[model samples]
Target: MTDLQIGNHLRKLRFLKGEMTQAQLSKNVGVTRQTIVALETSRYAPSLELAMKLACVFDCGVDDLFFWINLEDAKSKYSSDGQ
Candidate 1:
């Protein structure tokens, strides 16, 4: 079985929301813009409370915003792209 890694669709959600900036989303979520950046880049995983807050801002459920991917899938996707 593959390990799980958390991922998010924050960038797409922000774009759908009138091209909302990272700063705007962070402010609405009560977090720093860096946190929003990190989440969008998959460099960070939000706490449950933060996830709920983000979902609220997008008017969606947390599961719709974030998801667990198989680590092997991530590795292959990135590695094959030379990332």
Candidate 2:
């Protein structure tokens, strides 16, 4: 499994926007409710298209919803070679 960690701030935004249901958001984004659940739980990483769709739904930038943890970098023993 990938060690990357992604945040689902969209869920918070959706909640703020009249407590929107995942099903509704899913329909707007052309995805299944389970996809929304996975996204909210950070168990799945959406594609660029899905990310953009979600951003549109939340009325926010993709960066505002998802972020990379860079776990490998955090545990790196040596500086990266500029190869």
Error of 1 at 46 (Å): 0.5
Candidate 2 lDDT, 4-74, residue by residue in tens = 68877867888898999999989999999999999988889999999998889888899988988766775
Name the candidate that leads on lDDT: 1
> Which residue window of length 10 is worst by lDDT in model 1?
74-83
In the order shown, the candidates' Cα RMSDs to the true structure are: 2.8, 6.9
lDDT of 2 at 25: 89
RMSD in angstroms, candidate 1? Answer: 2.8
Task: Check candidate 1 and list the clashing pairs.
Answer: none
Off by over 4 Å in 1: 76-83
Error of 2 at 46 (Å): 0.2
With candidate 1 superimposed using the best TM-score fit, by how many Å does residue 62's alpha carbon deviate from the native? Answer: 0.5
TM for candidate 1 is 0.85
Q: Write the per-residue lDDT of candidate 1 for residues 41-65, one digit (tens) a residue.
A: 8889999999999999999999999
